[model samples]
Target: MTDWNGAALEKIAAAEELDLAPERPNGTLRDPVTMWMVRAGHRPYVRSVKGSDGPWYRGTQSR
Candidate 1:
């Protein structure tokens, strides 16, 4: 899809499409958080911590 001026309109369409993506429930952007952690002397490896009292908390849970 090209504009009236014969310019390639691919960039404009892609930007609008990204804006309609699903929302994140964390109330903050994940990408920025990951990047900041990387720059702040944090290790690249990560893991999840949870309580085992509930039935959902199993020892074999996977990321």
Candidate 2:
């Protein structure tokens, strides 16, 4: 099975289930998956290294 967390699902779902109307606003942009990660003390995974993950950029090493 997928390693997805259920409580996170509930939180995001609650936001999705809001009954906003034409004259009303939607809701919080803070998605539960994100918030859950935050509450769990997790961080958004880095997408990729901008350049090299080498210390050379910081003047600590040579290429």
My TM-score estimates for the predictions, one after another, are: 0.16, 0.21
Candidate 1 residue lDDT tens string, 7-51:
333333223222222224656533311111111122122222223
* Pairs of residues at least 3 apart in sequence or in different chains that clash in candidate 1: none
RMSD in order of candidates:
15.1, 15.4
Residue-by-residue lDDT tens digits, candidate 2, 1-63: 243367754454444223222221344332212111122222221111222462222322341
Top-lDDT structure, candidate number: 2
Where does the lowest 10-residue lDDT sum fall in candidate 2?
A: 30-39
Cα lDDT of candidate 2 equals: 0.30
> What lDDT is reached at residue 53 by model 1?
44
Please identify model 2 stretches exceeding 4 Å from their true place. Answer: 1-3, 17-63
Model 1, residue 45: what's the lDDT? 20
